[model samples]
Target: MSQPPQPPQPPNEPPQGGFGAPQDPPPGGFGAPTPPPADPFAKQPPAAPSTPPAGGYGSPPPPPPAGGYGSPPPPPAGGFGAPQGPPPGQPPQNPAYGYPQAPPPGQPPTQPGYGFPQGPPGQPGMPPQQGYGYPTAPMHPQYAAPQPGGGKKFSTQMQIIVAAVVAVLLIVGGGIVYSSSSGDDGGKQDEAASAGTDGGEGKGGEGGGLADGTEKAPADTKSKVGFQLPHPKVTDTTVVDGSWVTDKAYVKTGVNEIVGYDLAKGTKLWSIPLAGQVCAASRHMSKDYRTAIAFQEGKPSAADKYPSCNQVGALDLATGKLLWSKSVTSASNGDEPVRFNEVTLSGSTVAAGGTSGGAAFNLANGAELWKPKTDTNNCYDMGYGGGDALAVVRKCGSYDEPQLTIQALNPATGAPLSSYNMPAGVEYASIVSTKPLVVAADVGDTAGDGSSISDFFSIDAATGKLIVRISADADKYAADCGSTEVEKCTSLAVGNNRIYVPTEEHEGGGEYGDTNEIVAFDLTTGKLVGGRADAGDRYTLTPLRMDGSNLIAYKRPPYDKGGQIVSIDGSTFKETVLMVNPDDESVREAETSFSTNYAEFIYEKGRLFISEQMVSEPSKSSSLDDKQFLVVSFSTV
Candidate 1:
């Protein structure tokens, strides 16, 4: 439909004028009557001879006499040129002036009623009247009524619509901002959903809804919690080296000293000082934590003399008395005296492997069970897989291209279970075994110069069959590879269904900084299953024990900042840091150097007993004089 027309302007307003000026009226005045002129451009006709009618063949009737020539047109009626009056039944023109003027012979003059205002008579330059009649009253003022302040006012419905639109915009914009701000929180929620809540208190517990109809409150509101470590009594001052906790006692080794303490009261149970001064290398406790076997290296007598012999001693857990002691001939072959790096006890079998060779002894009487011939200069570590199965690695061949040959043997009979020849070019390597699976890590080409190659391999522990080999850049197969230029597995702690591997990365030419990470792998599927646990620079991780669904680890930061006990979920690999050493805080200066090492771990009931060392000294120490042994307990939440 078309819109309504706009109101007209007032009658007194003049017509707007612009670019073209209006022409003046003809030469005669506007009201003067004149005959129509003939067309100037019309064609002229030829002149014709004078002709007379037949009946009056003579010139036109003689012109009427001067006085008879229409009698001077009757003296022009009223005046020189006045108009005649209208005939009967006709109205006169110029009603306001009461002057009558003749109309056409038959038509009547229209009566003047309501029309446009005319200009006063005799006005010199007025425009002609328009054909349409004017309004009787001055247009009745078409504008709307003035508001209180003469401003436009919106209708009630329009105001409501505008308010609703603005509200919707605010709601949409707020949702976008909230989602962007909570992106990380959303990822945490996803992780929680997949891993399940099993660490903190009240996190997975049930709660009732409040009266306001909101759901149960969040668990973080419960309360904050802290931890404390049980103190161990210090007996005699000694250069403690190795320590391990059994069910009822703690055993510690020092240079020429081996001591045992009661778990309940911290009283000295017994001490076995060595005959010849020596440093303890490694120690192991039986599965029941009732017996311990320690390996010690004999000190050299003179610069030219080779170290005498390596010794392994068995001790009773409760009484701290020696069970048996045995000595093996040195396998040094003109090198420095050999030392063991790992000793393990399983049931009645005790096994030790070192730079000398790998050996298993009878736990009943300290009798040599098996001693393998040495082809390598060193055997860094060893692991026993139940009954008679033992896994060992020996470093052999040339110094430039050292080879680590992994072998599974019957410890009781010294018979080979299986064996595999590893690749050359690796300098250091370690092996771990779990009945059916064996994993080995080899680090090679320590001189850098672009010849470095580090790799990990998995083997069937039962049959010594190669399963898979993983490289440092094998993310899909081994996602926990270290980020350092030299990537190798540092420690292995195995649980019932999973294996925990801690790897290290050394930065800055392997001098100043180091980073540690722990990765959990599913033994059955051989797949990585959890997020990497990152322990910052200069920190090292050692697996302590794996109990039920949890794998406990000991983390050592640089320079004796003490140590912390970290609990990792076996399934998800989520970590909870717990039981940090409290005594380290009492040291006087921040620049002092300290060292703390986790010796062993024993988990019983709901408590964890950890044996460790607390050593503090200057950054440069002339002698090992400031080390102390400690045993502490941590309660599972």
Candidate 2:
């Protein structure tokens, strides 16, 4: 379960040999992470591009590498577990992975995406300092122009997975600033109350919001920066994990309040004050733009660095109002309200679970539906997965040897209609989907790559039977589920009775660089569906969410290019470019800055909004003049 070897650097660039040379893979362990070494290219300047090609931004990609995914690299000296790539800090020695590539003699430095840049070499004797800044001028480049194409060929050994990272963005001076206006239309605010239809209880959890998340592709996909929120300075790491988009506004969690912004213009609309910082937010939004959230009981004090996350509430996204906020006491924990770890929405119910146990309430008025009780067997509901159907992860037995039961619950009565017992030695399991009842877990501490999955359990939620068990090799697949948060999984989309995942990045089929694909696995048969959507040379695809049966995926930008959003057909596996961000180095930097794993990505209609899940004090390397981004929005015309 060691980290897979890093792919070889682009064949074109010379290797940087020195103190940060490749090291053996870190000791293998399931939970412990090897500290990343100093980034060798931290001070490196950004490479420049050469002359722009006449084909322009939307030009077709070069022909794929000769063999496609069918060509697999030879195994490492020590086989699959051998450390791959450079040790954590050392990126592959290639321009594609951010290393500078000097152009042929006599050529002037150009921009990155359109052409290669050439610069003078480092002075004699001094350890070469990698250059880091791109040319100040901006250049626009179109992305994967839509075209008819056949499905990408796949390797029999290839598996599907998705990976994302979360990081903060540093906005320097003279950057693009979003203009804001007041979103105070009282008439529209009133109409927001009845915006969504009743989706009715027990249908399933995946369907919510406009189009049930099936955003229509706009005719024009060209996009530019619509707006941005300067990162808020904070005393300590503060959680601001909630965000929702409505027809009238883009709502998000601020320090201790919920604020709404104009969806198109990034204007300030309205705010709803909360008792404390938001700790957990529901991924599901009611059709009417209503959602659930969990927050701290009070603001943190010097004496108490972190307060208990005990409050549960519902927010009316359209009107910008806190419909209800309530907490409950566990019989086993006496009078204090239970501190919940996660919250979710199921029809009219708001469910929250924590160490103290599980509880539910009416989504409309916060009326208590059920609360945890003292159990003779010490069984407690660890948490829940909510949406169309409500399911609970109930833990029983003793702390040393726990037994987990995944139960499909009655959203109205809190009764277990069906249940599936997990295998032994499985301490934590995440519900990847509730209605389909897919669960992911690192069975026996086998997935050593930090992705909390070794296998997937496809269960019949209506009958409490295991339909299929898909074994996922950590090194091959890239999906992840939070080790502790039952409902917090990303990089994979479940639809059409199949689980779609991206393969971990690998050497590509083109000369450009690393690439990945989106593949599907049958939920009922536990077999690969033999279809893939290639990210195409230098691009890596990460499944964001589903839009109806279609899968919406984000293509991480290559070193010199801008990022892309594409919609893949559920049946055909063909990709249609949705929004192609500008390729200007600074814009690409700002757009791709957020770590994929921790950032909140919401793409709808033709707009993509990326926000931080938590914010903290700036690092020592940060300058006082540096501005952080709270939420950056992009839109297509």
Candidate 3:
């Protein structure tokens, strides 16, 4: 779930109470559902919102259909629960989830501004809603959990096992590409901080595209519901964080199984039962439709509810086969299989990292490539970021004064090609992109927004030298990285020799809502580029990933509209709408429910899939029958 809104307005902005300004929740909490509008088609059109003229590549959306968003789509099937269709000529009632209220008539909206409101004000004109807005406190790393109550002492061997397990938990979810070499570089370590005297002239690596290659845009961009998976009942919040798309199947992680569904019909294709819960899943998939995941060694028991995340494996996403599953003995930890916190794939190597150390395996057949070494300086490979290239964040020094070494490695040999030492006082650094060698970290904790990033370091991976350091004021850009997960950054895309990030949601040009835009920074000069894609009034645009060289972004809908997916040209920064969802009440409600902060969005081959990374029991305030989706797919075909 989203943490909460964060960051106060910049110093120059006026205090709250402007257009799209967050407002106090009505008598009930924001989660309170709002009734849908009646006769959606017959209802007279709302007065055009008084929005200031602005230049954006995307044209203002055409007026809503006079007959309502086409025919209300057929009622969703199976696990989607039977949502009643609207009566003929009547608009579907809004779902119980609240939506923003239109501004009081004739009141002018404030000019565009940045930052979030200070208190628990409802989203601009929005009513009580169940979920939160932005992040507040940092989220716990996947394995990092609080210690159990009533601490009991254990024997040395048991303590060692327990410590290794704790170390595993400290690992954040992985997406990092890690490449490691020997610990014998005193000279390279000293130059890490001061190395980049001038930004390199090179245009990073080939820009953003899928694991396979750029996807061709479909002929018809209009989308309709394909399928929806109902939430699985779980006693606790279960981690189900993996999803992959192949030609024949759309595979997803279940409680203890990997299930594949037919691309179009959503019919079950195949299922591979896992030994235990999935702990970490690599974002990278091989060209042959293979990917890696980390899971527990066994099922939860009363004695050990949270088992160690020790098993690492590769799966054939196309065939639903567990290609290989194995673990490694940590020479430094009493020969125990190193409990991994995260796992990632680079070329034929599957790399997993934890507190005890990091290990790499041959992706083809699970042969050991390298294992954690016994180091005297307390250095351990914390994690790696993989994709296009592999890089690792190695931690050394004492616990109180830790130092991090970033390395670009040879995927096959685990040999470092280049290394950069992070400056003093940076406890964590997240790899935003591997090939481009973009790293983000909040040096000295100044980012206050839990983004874990204040600056971005563009490095020449081939030379282990810095290219440019782009300072991202937390109050300006909406980009974020997992505080502990070295590769789990979002809200930005790296491609076309630049980094595209969304400007923080600010008061929009409209008289009622807020808006934002995606802007780029030159990877070579750390300077803003001229290209920008505006989200228009009341809409917010977030970079999802790169579509080959172009950028794919999701445009969040206003309270009364359906969401849209747009493709932004890499060089021109012009946007082309890929999919525009239906504005039917039930459909819009379902689409809006998945907050960009916590859900996973995958748009490929004319299909968009949104799934929750984790699921927990509904709050008491939520109705037992309140509909929840595990995975929801929309397709233009």
Candidate 4:
């Protein structure tokens, strides 16, 4: 279970006996990060022409065409047990214009066809979900850009089995190399339980094989047969957010509506109605991808009118079959503007509803397993704590000085297994991940005076126990959480026994040097890994994911100068720019803004899927931009 100790730093002056002193190492002991050394004056975009993102993370490639996760995880250990690279001679990636080589030809069909069929359990002969149309043209390809190069390849024998020290990941071995195929994709999902990290050099957990990241990546590349869908044109509503459920991408079409489209061959599968925006689908959730859950926003059903909204539903992600949908008994006013804050499932428990209140239900049938202990408290904001537990952040204490409480509940039965009462000064907190560890943030911890408590903490998921606390100013996990002290940064990926957080450290100033922007920390020690800064330096970058052995970053400047998407070598921490963004005035305006209209990026099947963005212009369904919701898929197959 004991990991090799962190290498000791060599003395500044090497011993005289050593053969000629080793050549000075680059920033990461190899090539330096991309974009050249950070230039403080007159910053311009990376010099390169690139096709605009048709869309949208792995650096190491996947066998699943270009996209990642083409196939399911190797079967779990016992009932649930555990959890790639290119070769030499062949180029690790395509060097032409940053576009990946055309993917192979095995991409799966997005759906059967353009027709919206009555999904799985729609009233037997029910009419196809009404008012949905399909796209008929081919958009641009979401090319897979070269992200980080493989750090160092490990032996094929090296596997990331469950370790005792909270999933102590031995990342150096070619065990986790850069995807020779996947390359830079967008976005990442939180890591689930696999390695152990509670005590000294903990080894493997031998936990269920749900998500140990040890399973072999797909061998077959996911080829994208020419496919594109027009942006959905709805006046009353807009596509807010969505998830890639297996082969199809489920997105919020409009008010209380969701539509699924095949990313492979541009097929319109099904369109289901929704009540509101509170929605959650098990996208990268290994075997849990079968179900999708969302809150029914808007006025309550005839059965319950006391609360303006009180309905939650779950459906089969692929089949469109209804798993279970229920309305809750609430004391809320019908006029309250609220939707289920969190919708998650653990084991057999399906939980949907808002932070105000929610319940865990039976996955087999629509049965309420249990509700939160108190209505005044928030619902399941705390995500699933690895297995059958769900973490919930609730408000307790006097309103003027409310206290934050986190509860780990039994997903099947709303019983509190453990609860952590956060310190008093913290009024509100949000949960980022429950696995690896319970990471929560007190977003309200911002004040001019240093006394203001902007704090972030990690806790033990199984028990209501606090692990470590850092200044929220130092590292606020939430990207958009309002904080002026630092440039906005988000923790993009969690893997290999570490959490990757990228920040530009942009605190209102043009005086910026190439300081380490991306931060990777040990999941257990919470210490900077490798005693080295990230490879994202010299350029303003947004950390995306750990592609293969590299760290992919999006060089989307807030302005319109056409930026580049680059990757940082994991081992060397060297940066390489892969794709470039167009700098035309139109492209700049659309991408530079902090508008809520920004497209949602999701990773599935090795491909990065980007949903349509909310545009500034009003509707004219005939316009390609408004009429259809755009879904672009990228890969490095």
Candidate 5:
């Protein structure tokens, strides 16, 4: 019913507080307390259909002014509606480009390419992604704090670890380089060290590098030629002419015996026989080579103790005829036994020493020249010093404290020229050489001590002045020879300017044993020269003669099986072994025995006359009884 028009709702009434209530401002004003604000920008409702207003309302309120409509006032200049400045207390935004907001505190900053999922509240940004879909893992608990100082400290620690690792690698690399370099030179260093040790010259003229220096080759290059044992044809059995001439020829002493043979063809030249126990002929061919000195031990058929007799008989060189005969007797007494050890002839004078106690002789008349008194009953050795002068040695006392006196006597008048006293308790005394000077060796006592001492003296033959004296330790001279006892040093031999002394091995307080050695010493200076001559058991040194350039030595092998005639170069002291027994092999025995196997050697006219006595007998019997003498000859080319 439209009776009275409903009065229009007052413009300023309070808004109802219920569902679908019209939302309008209260009449009080904008300052009054208000409900929460609704979303202003929400979608607007659909427009309503056009309707005419009442006559009075139809006039619709005059249109509101443009500025009077309820609209937000124009935003203040440079506020939200316009290009405004940054908010208070915030940095200005970059005009060039825009980037995501920085992550909240304690979170990693965002990266452009990293796709991060939405994170929980408080985390404004997403978790960072890793390469190959791997999520960004959090730092270890040890590094959870995001301290700026801690980051710098961690960087320093990393640098130190990296530097340390690099240093260690460099050290290892240096070691490898050094080892390689050293290994490359190791062989050359060893070779150089070895070369310095060995001398330069080797055997056979080759070069050997020894520690010392190179040894020069010998000046004389001739090889040594060995001696040959003569094959003698036994035609007559009772032949006693086994004596060898110094000229390498033999003279027979029995009837129907071959006297001489062509050494090259073994042809018999002459035959003769004579009665004698010992015989010696001269080597001088222009002189009387047929003149032989014979010593008959006893009367041929008498048991009567006749004194030993010696005869110097002359014979024709072409025919076997006695030219003259002379007899010599010991002046002491008829009962005084006479033993002849050696007979020497100088020019025309003949001299001989007897085992009974004297030296007497004459070459032409066989008259008693002079007899010297020797205290010892045995005259071990005698030799002519020069001219008619004779040197004699005799054992005076016991073996422990033996007295050895060397006396020089005139053979023509029996006048004592000089005498020298040797050391006491000497086992042996030998006159080694008589030339510009006389060399002698007196071996002293060797008992409980480990070594033996030898006193070497050089005395003037004319004045008997002690020119030189030297003492040598026997053990130091020979290694295998134990020189601790009295040894029979009869093996002493002398050369032109040298003396060779033999030393044998012996145990302390034991009997003299037999390991043999030959040591050479300078005659003038007494200095040791060449290497030692080791003949094993075959060490017997006999001085033959001194030629122009060489010294001859006849060395008997050990055990006396045979011997060799060696020629030593006087200048160089090199030896050449000229003779050796073909059947003799090295043998050892426990007993002391004399070797009857004689290599009778003599040097004259630049030739060596060697008589090798070959005896075939059982070892039980005496080798002297069944002796056979064969003569051979040799010469240097």
Candidate 6:
């Protein structure tokens, strides 16, 4: 930042499209849904979604086949995401991936290239379907009910709010279905509603896979028949993060409220309103996994040059009652708001770090533990992994330290455990996976802005010694980031003591790219296990993780909606494509790189939860409106 002004992209990190990190721009978030703050349910949430004949919950219907949530609704006559005629000024819907970069054959690139993926216009003979393409505004929302006298009422006691979404529900006589629309230029909009019948006739399935090839969960898991929670309406930018503790879901329902719902019944178990804004990224849980710690970013102060009001609070995950709380301090880099950069816990010790510095507190009663010297030593970025081991980089672009030093700290005492020094010429380094102990570094060309990852290293989590380094013949980190795109810092994924890397030749034909396949290497040995091929010539796929023992990667469709979730066998690399995309193509497209995606997908306790972000950007702004949040859960049973 000091040498010379590089091309400045948006400085502020958008919500990791799904549940992501601020410094990283992967849609949902930076860190994958590994642990805390990643998935709303701390560890595991509820069962699979199901459609039972009035007997959906308590009795738990007969189990479904592979991929829990039942199959698609027979691929609707027009296929998924097929638009139903447009609203009566909007240009004739050009069924194509609306990416601004590679404009449809005849259309020009949208102004201000943000580098997001765009969809191609409809093919000559197929129904229009775009997955991960340019997010387009739906033209079918803002519903109203007739008034008793002369006008319709929106908030009157007489107004009955029956449906929160009415976009698409595959399977006519079974799942919920309705259409919605929004303003074209990003103005105020609403989701359409319909007078849907409560019950319908449809056979519950043994197969959990949808028609489009989304994965199916186990038979014992329940399939999602409908949405359980209300769309989260947030007034601020606080992300609606969730966690699972004791068979319940701890979800942030609003700016000031965090609610715990009984996953089995979707019933309100408890609700805890924070004293300050809950920073989802600062989320942590104790060694016993009973208490949940989230940083309460207090209101900002106007006096200081760099002001922030932040605190750390712990709550009983089960009861939602306050356990303890204490104020926190950080090391500052003036002119920027002091935000908590990282949070971790070891035993009963709680630690946090920021641009300012790092501090530790007792987890039980929220008393000061000690102020360790984390800010000095040429390190500013603190990351945690391997459950409790805290990793910090020596040179975090703070003072032009030539080489990068990697150090492991005893989170409880903030004492050094193990340390390694990376060679010079490294511009940036990030701990990609803690479980597998991998770090990704961006060693930029000294003379240009062109950047690509320089190497991949496996370090000893306990000893902090270098074990293996792969700088060639490996997948370079996928450098693409977006408001809704997955994997902000793409490069690697770790699952079951194995590391998965996608080849560098996958994408970049246009906004979105494809990967030939993901290559697996033994976690400790760094030996190649196997490489699986992509489904098709341009199937854009990114590995999410080795979900359980099965490697799960998302096959990003070319369009804005209708992407497929596929699972690959870790051993055989055999892939199974499941019809799991929850976005109906009518939701808000994640638009700009700074815009938020419509939904963040998280898998917990065998069930898949979709956290829907605002679909339409508020007019006059190109970012998330931060006024809406919705969590839809699915399972296979």
lDDT of 4: 0.40
Q: Which of candidates 4 and 6 reaches a greater lDDT?
A: 6
Candidate lDDT values, in order: 0.41, 0.66, 0.67, 0.40, 0.37, 0.43
- Best of the two (2, 4) by TM-score: 2
Count residue pairs with overlapping backbones in model 3: 20
**Per-residue lDDT of 407-478 in model 5, one digit per residue for the tens?**
665656756677666666655454444454443452545322322334567766677676656555544332
Report residue 11 deviation for candidate 1 (angstroms).
99
Candidate 4 — which residues are off by over 4 angstroms?
1-231, 236-239, 247-255, 275-288, 297-308, 331-339, 353-355, 375-389, 447-453, 472-478, 481-491, 505-516, 531-540, 543-598, 612-630
Question: What are the models' TM-scores?
Answer: 0.49, 0.69, 0.69, 0.52, 0.44, 0.54
**Tens-place lDDT digits, model 4, residues 1-637:** 0111121221331111100111111121111122222223114445543643232211112112222221223322321112222356765653222111222356422221222232235332222222343211221122122237734332111211111001111121011111111222221222221111110111122211113222122333222323434344333222243455464554434335556666554466777766553323432232644554554445334664322334556666666555666666533524443344345666677765444455667766777777655444433232333233466666665657776677776666767777788887765454545564444454454533222224446677677677656443333222332121110113355555555655433321112223224555554554444422222222344555556556655544433244344445554444444444444443333333222113455443344454443322333433322122254444422
lDDT of 3 by residue, 46-126 (tens): 577577334232322222233321111121332111234577999966532211112235753221112211112532221
Q: What are the root-mean-square deviations of the candidates from the true structure over C-alphas?
A: 44.4, 20.5, 25.2, 24.7, 54.7, 21.7
Query: What's the distance in Å from true for residue 449, model 3?
Result: 0.4
lDDT of 2 by residue, 194-310 (tens): 011110111111222224346655555667888988667677666778788888899888989999999988888999988888878998999999999998888877765566778
lDDT of 6 by residue, 415-484 (tens): 7678777766664466656554676664444312122345567888687788877442322323222212
Candidate rank order under lDDT: 3, 2, 6, 1, 4, 5
Local distance difference test, candidate 1: 0.41
